[model samples]
Target: MVEKPGDSPHLLVVDDDERIRALLQKFLARNDFLVTTARDADHARRILSGLDFDLIVLDVMLPGDDGITLCGELRAHQTTPILLLTARAGTEDRISGLEAGADDYLPKPFEPKELLLRINSILRRMPAAEPGAGVPKVLHMGPLRYDIARGEMWRGAELVRLTATESQLLQIFSDQPGAPVSRADLVARLGRSGGQAQERAVDVQITRLRRKLEDDPKQPRYLQTVRGAGYMLAPD
Candidate 1:
């Protein structure tokens, strides 16, 4: 297994076609994603059962089970964003995918760059922060707690250990609360330049923090996105 970089976004690609699967995996990886490829829905399910992913790129047509059914199944348990790929271009097909818990859908014969953009958009919409204003230095949300000034996280009485990057990232979100904190702001707050590498690093830290704070890390409740603005930490 590749040791995922602390900053790279982890993505799972599910497709039956070997050519498309490999092509997408390599392309996404080159674009700063930590890509994992599965040959079919069964393979994807096995991988999903064992590891966590930030998003899934699932082809609507699979070997045995259809992607829409699998999408519904995944949405029932996880909040990770799903982007569906299909040969069908009908509005009804697109709507069905969205209704089945897909965050977005793309018809086949589309550009990979567009897929990348859509992926980023869906991830951006995921909880980057919770809602609150002028939140206290010590923030509480559900079972998780954080000491903003000290850069600490806690789940109930137990102290949760965070990597240095993770601590810094959480602090940035906690400070803003309901306000969206941009990627540039996050880079500057963490004392790094606003380069692609640093931005990717922020992603890694956010993923780690979500795993720690969210009841279901796959579906965050506290940290959410504010559209074009940036990430927000919404505390209870």
Candidate 2:
């Protein structure tokens, strides 16, 4: 069925490449998604201030505050899912994007259909966690408290920022607190492909989450690694 206006998911495409921006805008629009284009980070920020989008497709190499930096900054306020487009397909580059809070990363020169698939996949899991995944209204982690329903974590009245991926992971772990969630399961839940690289990316996200949930991220307390299993969130 054809979707009506305002019923389609809205997307913000931020890229310095004119051709890519126009191509994505047209292609995503044809797919029934409402698309907004931004030439660079500054422009994206300006557009973002006045608009809300379900997802953001951002280019890594932008004019100012490159996409990674911008993604980190955006995570501080909103939990909009972000899929990064980068020319650098190296593992390190991909890990950097994940660390910065991107929901997914797609290398440049990728097929449009693949991008569409990724977009749809991410949107399908936009709710963060599956229904019946129960947890306490507020899960305590030492000085930190996570409001499960709100998907928010706070430290002494100050709200702790989590990337969209990190927030989703928290909700998944919260759903089954004390139980170990395998890296493969985490990758699947995160809507990423299964592979050593994908699992490594999941680990990077867990490490990032630990930084926020632990006073000593080096030796985590609440979010713990359970060898032979995976990771277990042992909340206090």
Candidate 3:
């Protein structure tokens, strides 16, 4: 049964086809998701600049910038999970989508139920901040400061903007300050299915995150990589 919309996940559906766009929005909205529709890549970018979404449902073939190229561009800055929809179902096409940074791919004419299941599964794997209650809310890492309660990161006096995925990763590391978190564990915690590809994707995210948190991303002091264990966060 499709879940009813309430305080549900927000999704951006990008497609050039007006009918498909409207249909998806209505269908996903009925299934307990906050749905936003965009005509094409440009429209999607404009909407994205103002609002945040939990996931993006992008159509591969569009009038303007293709979904694969757009997905790659977005992945450079945003870590929001993306599911690409394409008519092509070849192995190479699916791999190309993954290479472009899509979290999942769905061929056209797919069951709405399957889409709902995939969305729910991805959301379930995303890491969430644990209840701090009376515990310390502020974590200090040199000039970088993270507030667990607020899910905010600040550098010195400036507030840092983080994508949803980055925030989730920060919360995960902050929860266990100095302990190592294996790549496999991180993949699972981040709402991703286990695999070597996903592990590499996690590494990419960590690299991007380190650029924001560390003075020298090449030799990261705060987010360090353990030899065999995985990665650890050390806040001083």
Best by lDDT: 2
Ranking of all candidate structures by their lDDT, best first: 2, 3, 1
For all candidates, what are the clash counts? 15, 0, 2
- Give the per-residue lDDT of model 3 (tens digit) for 1-43: 1344656889999999999887888888877788888889999
Clashes of 2: 0
lDDT of 2: 0.88
Tens digits of lDDT, candidate 2, 13-81: 999989988888889989999998999999999999998999999999998789999998897778789
| Model 3: lDDT to the true structure | 0.83
RMSD to the true structure for each prediction, in A, is 10.8, 3.5, 4.6
Alpha-carbon runs more than 4 Å astray in model 1: 1-4, 130-236
Cα lDDT, all candidates:
0.76, 0.88, 0.83
Per-residue error at 10 for model 1, in Å? Answer: 0.3
Instruction: Give the per-residue Cα lDDT of candidate 3 at 22.
Output: 78
Worst 10 residues of 2 by lDDT: 127-136
